[model samples]
Target: MVSKRGRIDTFVAKRLQIPKKMVRNLIASEQLFIDGHQVLTADTQIDEFSLIECQGNVLQQRQRAYWMLNKPKGVVSATIDNQHVTALDLLAGIDKDLLHIAGRLDLNSTGLLLITNDAKWSQRLMAPKSKVTKRYLVTLANPIDSTYVAAFAQGMWFEYEGITTQPAKLTVLSKHQAMVELKEGKYHQIKRMFGRFQNPVIELHRESVGEIRLDDELGEGEFRALSTAEIHSINVNASV
Candidate 1:
């Protein structure tokens, strides 16, 4: 209730069950605040994450939540799904409705997944201009050779999208496994990239997103809130 972002007067009125006139009066008397700052106008906009206070009493104070989940195979990166278990379903005792996946992995893919209620934070992390790197460990059906390294660096051309991929870094970890780092995520990019070599990706596990690595202690389907440093590492201009 009163969760959508809108003018402060409207939010305050709905949240407090008071008249709009009373909300304006509270603002005029300097008795209303948003995010700890005094509201100067009834028209001031506020989102669900905004901290609202009045007369030393908390009207609404919703802290931004960020989490890192070790997504297991077959779990869809969605808030809800009818045919499968969504990533949000794995979270316990948290407001799952307000959370969304930052960088989504396919149902068959596993590893590091970012979930948060802060839309701005997630948007910045996933923005193309941000160029945040995502690293993955891939197991292929065929042996990886030096050619694969050069091919990835050169970038692959997708006939359907009609756009070439950005230069990616690939390190051959073994005859059939390698580490891949990319600044962009396209539809089935990893699988399709391997497809160019006629090799199938049998396993794909993301290791990190930008500077936030998957916690070694988190088991599959387990998650923990992101640390202060981890949340700030995305280089978002605004505070969570």
Candidate 2:
């Protein structure tokens, strides 16, 4: 009940208010039927929306939830932390632990943070081989120029990794602000890339990920469940 996913035996025990051993006995007795088929194993995985009928009584499934948060600065992208408040703390009326951060925003950065319980969906988005584009609004301490376009398009070398980053798209929005799009994530990538020109980053915010753009109506710290179409935008095809 508290979680959307769990073993069938645990659900049976909770629903019947009996011990797990009793649930196992009931499973052995063929009293538990999952989706109308009698199951001998208590380990049958069930979701929040599973139709579990045991001796004519129906067990409800917990509906999966997905959300997008306009993450505010200073909130760490984590479920729990001892020193800093996490983005999950900003959410209300949901099981925070059940949800996960698909893409992390740095403590000093903000915008378009996705929250979901679907592991496969998140995995697809984070897969290194996936070409899903992440767009960011970057503020720099120096003025912008056309040379950055060619440099970013060609990729930047990070000495620490001894590897050049994947080609990125950089569009100048203003003297101090620019739009940057990348298909891969690197540690402090934008900051490090700009550091090559001695141009420090003043501010950073993620504007979008793939086809899912940040909701203009949602304020920082607020979130809403992703629409069906929005969820469909995630491309799981890894082979290209």
Candidate 3:
């Protein structure tokens, strides 16, 4: 879990479910150390990912959590935001601040969003080398045709990014809606792809990442902790 800055004593008290006075007494007895250095006062700030020990025994931190959220349209995909509510805020009964978003949804787009406290897992999920497939449902302003599918399959050169995107899978659902799967994230990739054909995107919703699909049971703004099998899905490389 990402450590929130606070007094070592206060953090220990809350984390261990003990009293602050007891934490102070433990520190005074030279029973506490932050990352292997003995500290006399509880006032010391806890550093991120620092190990805490009491009387030579390491304190057990809570297990890391992996969750899937049906992100609402208005919330930002961040841990903290000054002017908007973040997706983490929807989570209850947990240290939401310790959680980090794996794949981000745009502010107006809504769908399956991944959140977790495992930094390395999140990092790997977003890494270019992983090539995890991300699936989205897109609605367009105009009716689309076979040309759109062919173009996407062949890969398109995005002028703004000055790079050709990897070949993407596009399936036409209706004249104005389609389902797309991409192995790489580009800035506004779907919208930009349709822009080539003079069609504006009316809506976009993510449906899944890798093998971990958003639970259909989850309504907008609702989230559920991932099961062990679902958590393991992040490590699996599968085509959407």
Candidate 4:
């Protein structure tokens, strides 16, 4: 027989309107007990047969979350700071305490951005072995040369301030615009790469990552959580 009555500690916490985290902290600090047995983890999943008490403080569950933010230009992708604006600021009314960005877009660049508290999934996308190809649409102030296209695709090691980078996959989508894919990410990379040819970027947008494209319906500064199908597809495509 199953009942929703719950365990001793669980019943006590729920009845007293106390949070489980506080209950855990109480247990950790030796301020709580269950039938004279000391509690260790909050995950004890207690029933009416147990006992629970909190000397002081409250507890709450951490909400797990994931979201895509249509990051507008001039937003920094960091948390825990007072600045003009951070990508986390875009999460207003969103699940607070969500983790870091899966990949980064430059502050001056605008487009799709993924934020999730899931460390494992975040690590998967950021892993070097995954080699997830990120697609970017770049509009240059000047027309692109065909010779540059060949060299860009063949891989051009960008050297700046004594630091050199590996080659990237580059292609020309049009005369004044180009489509480039990079398996590796660096600080302000795309902008610097085009700077070498005296082509200043007029506009930039990240179109896709692997097989998942940013939803076209999303306006600037808008976002939605990715479906499970999209998440699975990233892993599947990375394997191929």
Candidate number achieving the greatest lDDT relative to the actual structure: 1
- Point out where model 1 deviates above 4 Å: 1-5, 16-19, 55-57, 236-240
Question: Which residue pairs does candidate 3 place in steric collision?
Answer: none
TM-score of each: 0.91, 0.82, 0.77, 0.70
Q: Rate the local accuracy (lDDT) of all candidates.
A: 0.91, 0.86, 0.85, 0.71
> Of the pair 3 and 4, which is ahead by lDDT?
3
lDDT of 1 by residue, 1-240 (tens): 123668999887887899999988998899998888999998998888788899899988778899999999999999989999999999988887578899899999999999988887887888888889999999999998999999999999999999999999999999999999999999999999999989999999999999899999999999999999999889653222
* Candidate 2: worst-modelled 10 consecutive residues by lDDT: 231-240
Model 3: per-residue Cα lDDT at residue 73: 87
> Candidate 4: lDDT over CA atoms?
0.71
* Total clashing pairs for each candidate: 0, 4, 0, 7
For model 4, residues 38-155, the per-residue Cα lDDT tens digits are: 6676656654223444554323334445677888888877765576588888777776554678898877787878887766566777777788878898999998977776666665
Clashing pairs in 4: 6-47, 7-46, 7-47, 7-48, 8-47, 19-59, 22-59
Cα lDDT of model 3 by residue, 1-240, tens digit:
333567898878987899999999898888999878897777998744668888877874446778999998889999889999999888977786467898888899999999998776777788888889899999999999898889999999978789999999999999989999998989888888889999998889999998889899999989998888877776665322
Show model 2 residue runs off by greater than 4 Å: 1-25, 40-60, 235-240
lDDT over C-alpha atoms for residue 97 of model 1? 54
Candidate 2 or 3, higher lDDT?
2
Model 1, position 184, has a per-residue lDDT of 95
